[model samples]
Target: METASAESVRKHVRVYVTVFVALMALTLITVTISTLHLQPAAAIIVALCIAALKASLVAAYFMHLISEKKLIYAALTLTVVLFLVLMVLPVSHFADRGL
Candidate 1:
């Protein structure tokens, strides 16, 4: 039992370290993207995509959401849907104004 527990802890630690490394790599990519001087719209899109991935990593492992129940996933889906709607609202409004 102790061996099993120790193995589980090591596995969890490994996952955490991997996630940390991935997050750091993503941060570096973000910095590199910024230096590319992309157009504002393209840069925003790229940045948002990277940000979403980073957020997912944090939510899944750091927040222990990967092992959560269906109800939790449903709620998270709802939140994402609402967030996307909120994000689009401004863009749509600007489009309507010909901006």
Candidate 2:
């Protein structure tokens, strides 16, 4: 088993604190945006964008995925690509409709 030094521990703590602060800020911003009287479509898109960003932050930091191996990163990338494809499929319903 390898042992890390005090400095390394402190660094990890600092990163964790930063991540926490960022997550809190994102949460606050999302809440504030939701309260605004945006058009339905715009509000939905904006909320989805914020949700995606928050998910990324949680996955990267809270999940410790930022320190993961290359294979994990590849998997994460693929997952995001698939997610995007799925997200766009619902838009086809609006294509034939008159705005």
Number of residue pairs clashing in candidate 2, backbone atoms closer than 3 angstroms, sequence gap of 3 or more or interchain? 0
**Highest lDDT among the candidates is held by which one?**
1
Please give, for residues 1-99, the per-residue lDDT of candidate 1 as tens digits: 124477777887899999999999999999999999999999999999999999999988888787777898899899999999998999999999999
Stretches off by above 4 angstroms in model 1 are 1-6
> Model 2 misses residue 58 by how many Å?
1.4
List RMSD in Å for every model shown. 3.5, 3.2
lDDT of each: 0.90, 0.81
Indicate the residue-level lDDT of 33 in model 2: 88
Give the per-residue Cα lDDT of candidate 2 at 77: 89
In the predicted model 2, the residue pairs found to clash are none
* Candidate 2 residue 56 C-alpha distance from true site, Å: 1.9
